[model samples]
Target chain A: GQQVMQIPQYQHVQEGEDFTTYCNSSTTLSNIQWYKQRPGGHPVFLIQLVKSGEVKKQKRLTFQFGEAKKNSSLHITATQTTDVGTYFCAGGLQAGTALIFGKGTTLSVSS
Target chain B: DTAVSQTPKYLVTQMGNDKSIKCEQNLGHDTMYWYKQDSKKFLKIMFSYNNKELIINETVPNRFSPKSPDKAHLNLHINSLELGDSAVYFCASSHRQSYQETQYFGPGTRLLVL
Candidate 1:
């Protein structure tokens, strides 16, 4: 069985500060996807990484995939109230298989 | 139009009762999935369907059964629901065309068994 684990299960940061969440998988993944769930809302897809040592940026957010394809990270710069939500990293074991999601890192930002 | 839609957004019923949640996707995707999110928000896959065919069943309880009327509709029926069955269930759809499968999720149905 494949498993994905995330660090800092809970994070509380003030506005203008930075935040980062790390994800590791028990087995090598073919691809990884990131999702965000706002309070009382469904999970929304954000980005996906396939190549090893790949880095993608979306405005104030940055995503990185490990060289081994077993780990990933999400970093947010100058967090805002809109950034409060749970970030999940899902690892794809093989083609056409269900993704294994991590416990997720819940981000809380206070002004 | 909503890409993925679900019926009965909120359900409150007593234990031992039977209930069903319905899901439909308009994206014309080949694959649809059912996932459960517990109080801790840990998402786990329960079942998957491809082109109206059951493709994956992830050790879910026998009381829970999923049916696909067509490629666009997938429904879940729960019998003899227990207190532990209370959770938010989400239905998602994805195209099986490429390696990076981007899943489109619908607003989850919250079920509470008393």
Candidate 2:
């Protein structure tokens, strides 16, 4: 069975501080996608990474895929209240297969 | 217009009753999926439909059935629901054109079984 796990299931940070969540897997992933879910809301797609050692930045957020494609990390440069939500990392089992999502890392930014 | 939509945004019913959640996507994607998010916030895939054909069926109970009348619509029916059936169910769709399949999700339908 392919399972994805995330570190720091819960995290709280000041508005100006930084935050990060790491994801690890036991098997190599063909591709990885990150999603964010607001409180009492559905999951929203953020970005996807396919190449190994890939790093992408979107405004204050940075996403990195490990060289082995079995681990990933999401870093928030400067956290804001708007960034408060749970971050999930999902990996596809194979081509044309369902994705397995991680337990998710909940981020709470307090002013 | 929303790309993906589901009916009955909220449902509360008694145990042993049957209920169904309907979903439709306007993106014209060839693949659709049904997922369950438990209290722990773990998203699990229960079913996947590729071009109206059942492709993936996890260890979901047989009481749960999914029907896809066409590529634009897929519905889920639960029979004799139990307490464990109370959770938020989400419908998602993705195009099969490439390997990087980015899924578009709809606002989930919350089900509460008492």
Give the range of the ten consecutive residues with the poorest summed lDDT in model 2 chain A.
A91-100
**Runs in model 1 lying further than 4 Å from the true structure:** B97-99
lDDT per residue as tens, model 1, B41-96: 99998999989888889999999999999999999999999999999999999987
Give one digit per residue, the lDDT tens place, for model 2 in B1-114: 999999999999999999999999999899999999999888998998989999889999999999999999999999999999999999999886233688888899999999
lDDT score of residue B100 within candidate 1: 72
Q: Which residue pairs collide in model 1, if any? A: none
List the lowest-lDDT window of 10 residues for candidate 1 chain A: A92-101
| Residue B29 in model 2: lDDT | 99
